[model samples]
Target: MSDTLLTDLHVKYIQNLGKNKDDLTYHMTAHLRMNAVYWGLTALCVMKHKDALDAEETIEYVMSCWDDEAGGFGAHPGHDAHILSTLSAVQVLAIHEALARIDVTRVVNFILGLQHPSGVFAGDQFGETDTRFLYCAVSALSLLGAIDRLDRERTVTYLASCRNFDGGFGRVAGAESHAAQVWVCTAALAILDRLDVIDVPTLGWWLAERQLPNGGLNGRPEKLEDVCYSYWVLSSMAILNKLTWIDSAALTRFILSAQDSEDGGISDRPGDMVDVFHTLFGVAGLSLLGYPGLDDLDPVYCMPASLIERMGLKKGWKALPRRL
Candidate 1:
């Protein structure tokens, strides 16, 4: 109820997410099952309680979602493999140090196979392309240490085409700039060491403007603030080394105010229903803002900073100093 993170309650909340399988909401979200696991697991890690979820059981569930026929992961058992779910599967395995359980070579090939001639990636065999899928592919390959197999120049060229005059990026070439799209393109460039392609000051200014008078951030101009943008906007700013451009204290308060005091999660905005996605992004934003009693998040990869550093993929992105 206070203006502070409900750490224990959130950990318990995440712990219970997979227990109610018989609930209608659980079946309704089968398409997001893998992603929901990733979000819950990562949120627990940020809370410094990765053990809250049993590693063995978690790994088993993740492996069950594997589409052996496609060599990638599906959102849930019996679903089609997708780049988005594939990335989530990879992230969950990496966090639990269980990547060895899957065929890295096959997964890498599956991801590489999704790249279009234009260099963007599709979500799956359906062929819907977007910068988000590109990031998922890039991030997954990087985690598997197969990034060298990707066409770096072509990827960069496609990202460059998506850039807008306002210094932000869109889902595709010539589309209007959006915060979420900017994050994927910017983060993918960071993974490729291609930040040089971005107009730093111009993009930084555009990102800073996402923070509104309410202290929360909107995906774009004329949009209402959402907790998820806490990650999209702040992570991009941290990567750009422009974190100070926004009001950290105000943003922190805004995120905390959106907490589900009784139920133990965070929502898009204050008084909204809480879910794992917004909860992770909200807490991650606080960590980036230097809130006390939290772990550092690698803005570039959206993973634990120490884990990324241990793997030698840590970027030069900045986060506010953690309060003692």
Candidate 2:
């Protein structure tokens, strides 16, 4: 296992992802093409290599995903508009400083229209409500400078309902606690400036327990440790100002061990096939862990810290100091 980040290899891997349109995996992931782009781009940004991808072409591809009929973005050209992809579109545009390419008023309305009276948000017209969707809405709106349109009270109440007694959150109200859900709820509250909704001490304790003896994190109890949870878990701790709770050194080593030293991507665990989703989250986790030569990541937005700060969207989270 490599003890250091293979930054150059990972950059090349991301650049090659959208190539070879005939590849089965490429076709299979069409439903998430927009999100895949955001994941790859954000990973590059965290690695201090945003220019690795062509800016104008990438922005144009992001714009092409727009679902004009719905005033939102789809996962790909022909896919229906969904809140998840819409948020990905917004984030990628924000990272590129290209938000002006989108119609803010219509996109804001499309997102607000997804919110039910219950304050929970659906992914798209199909109506599957999740706390994750709620975060996507809040975040997208904030990036567009339209957060004022959100019903703060209702949104916070809905998030409160999703909080488990264990102090972690679930996909929906009354569901079991999972680290991913905890991140959505916590980060949403952080962005909404309503983090008082969380029971900090209890949540901190629960988050700390996610770390296993192997030094990786699992999403929930009894699950195997995975690379994605490194972000889901660490970002939660960072937002809560509790970075000291995790064994950062051990977890960092675990993340580096999962890297594809030969082909350049991160997998769910060691010896698995690497992909963009895990790669972004792994690099993100490393950034929060103060890995050397990496740029700071805004845990709340999962974008570059400098970009988030410049946009006036920085939240109250703190990551470990960048190591030399």
Candidate 3:
């Protein structure tokens, strides 16, 4: 996409939110899926206009989504909490340098409450388990700097159960493999410091099969290409240290083709609606392709350069084993 188009889309996304007055608060009318859009949009806006937005104000709005009683975040103040909303809440705060404002211990406890004895994570107290919850749990724990709070061995074993013989991961044990599940599994393994447990070469082969002739990736073999899967499948390969196995040039072209010039965002496919969710992943995909003006994002942990620096984490950020 042209530089001018990218700039325009970014501007449009920010403008769509309109002005925020002192008494203004984000309406909590949507579910967790919609909350992802809010946090994603907030992060995108902050990145685009750091000086224009009051970082403190933006942070407070995002933090309002946290449901302290439920020990997880929700779409709005009174909404039920879930792992997905909790992850987005933390990520948006981290992006805005507001994590220090949160109660780290409480957040960690909330995340720990979602873990099942079998190593899978449920979304909340309701016990809805899925691969997406696993991703949220891993990511949220990593953000809080408290991943060790979970039973790592059990979690790893649970992750292993989700791996299919086809060299991909599934939402649950014995389920069909999917590209999104592969991303979650890959990221979780990276966070747990056990990516080696899976057969990287075989998994990489399965992921490669997702690439379509149009250059974007599909959720499964023989599926049509979509922009979101580009980040899911490509980032999984990056986490596995196997990004080179895919055609970078072709994927880059596909992502660029989905750019909506009139607005400042990307869509799942050409002629689709542009939103913050796909826009962030779309930029992330470009960053993976070594795009200029973007920092090198950690494939395993999706935090930006600033937060990584603040944590004093080593370049690769591997977990150190405890001495016996």
Candidate 4:
């Protein structure tokens, strides 16, 4: 029932994440440990609390997840390398400006090796090819300043294939157009400098249709509205410079209502348990919405705009002006 973001409590909530090893959920989500760190870190940064987590320790944890054998990072220590975790690792380090700690050359090769001839990428040595993994590879490479080494035409060809008649993208060619997949695909296309491949006007209308009567957005048709789409859907619209297409005030209230006012973190919807994933997206979405007191988020990178701009990787996306 809250209309305002509980920023201070959310900060404390993020600060306390992974502190309770006795919790079963900690062990259950080991595969997402690296990404959780990235999520938590990026959330902190957008809230203008980048130093809320100890920098040395944060960067150290990122390094510990590095898989020496694969030259890329893993979800947790001793896990195998994967494109998703690799991108999270790159993002974490790049945000902290500590990319020099890892061997970029090998990491680049590890990522490059995962791409199939068809331009889609596999998640890891195992096989799960999707546009999600494709975006991960492109994003990780762009952050490393090695995207030029990627086969652009071949890569964008796969992206073009993922486009559906509705002007939205899917996890794979012919798959249903999902909001999450749309962000990854749209952001990846922006990183590749390939907006021309997208049918923006049609996609914009389709994305606008995601907003429900309650002001929250759902992934696709008939799905329940969730807080995470605050980032997924809003970010995709922001990248297309269509932020004005959605009702920001109502959507912002929807995001704030999903927050755990007393406990800090946000959930998929109000009355649900909050987690770092939704917490990050909720905060990121607010930033994009120009909520007063929040720092700007670069919708494409999902990081602080300053950090992205400093790396010379800023794109031409637009966010709403901050409230007075």
User: Which 10 residues in a row give candidate 1 its minimum summed lDDT?
Assistant: 1-10
Per-residue lDDT of candidate 3, residues 1-324 (tens digit): 553227455645655543432323333325643355443544354244434445676577667777767766787666778878888888777666678888888888888888888989998888989978988888788778887787889889999999988889998999999998998888888778787778988998999888888788899977899888877887788777677787877887888888887656788888798766677777767766675545555556565645566765423432111112
Please report, as a residue range, the 10-residue window in candidate 3 with the lowest summed lDDT.
314-323
Superior candidate under lDDT, 3 versus 4: 4
lDDT of 4 by residue, 210-268 (tens): 99999999999898999999999999999999999999999998999999888899999
Q: Which residue runs does candidate 1 get wrong by more than 4 Å?
A: none
What tens digits encode model 2's per-residue C-alpha lDDT throughout 187-265? 9999999989899999999999999999999998888999999999999999999989989999999999999999899
Task: Please give me the total number of clashing residue pairs in predicted model 4.
Answer: 0
- Clash counts per candidate, in order, are 0, 0, 3, 0
> Which model is ahead, 1 or 4, in terms of lDDT?
1
lDDT winner between 1 and 3, please give it.
1
Question: What is the C-alpha lDDT profile of model 1 across 185-276, one tens digit per residue?
Answer: 99999999999999999999998899899899999888899999999999999999999999999899999999989979999999989999
Worst 10 residues of 2 by lDDT: 59-68
lDDT of each: 0.94, 0.95, 0.73, 0.92
Model 4, C-alpha of 47: deviation from truth (Å): 0.8
Off by over 4 Å in 2: none
* Clash count in backbone of candidate 1: 0
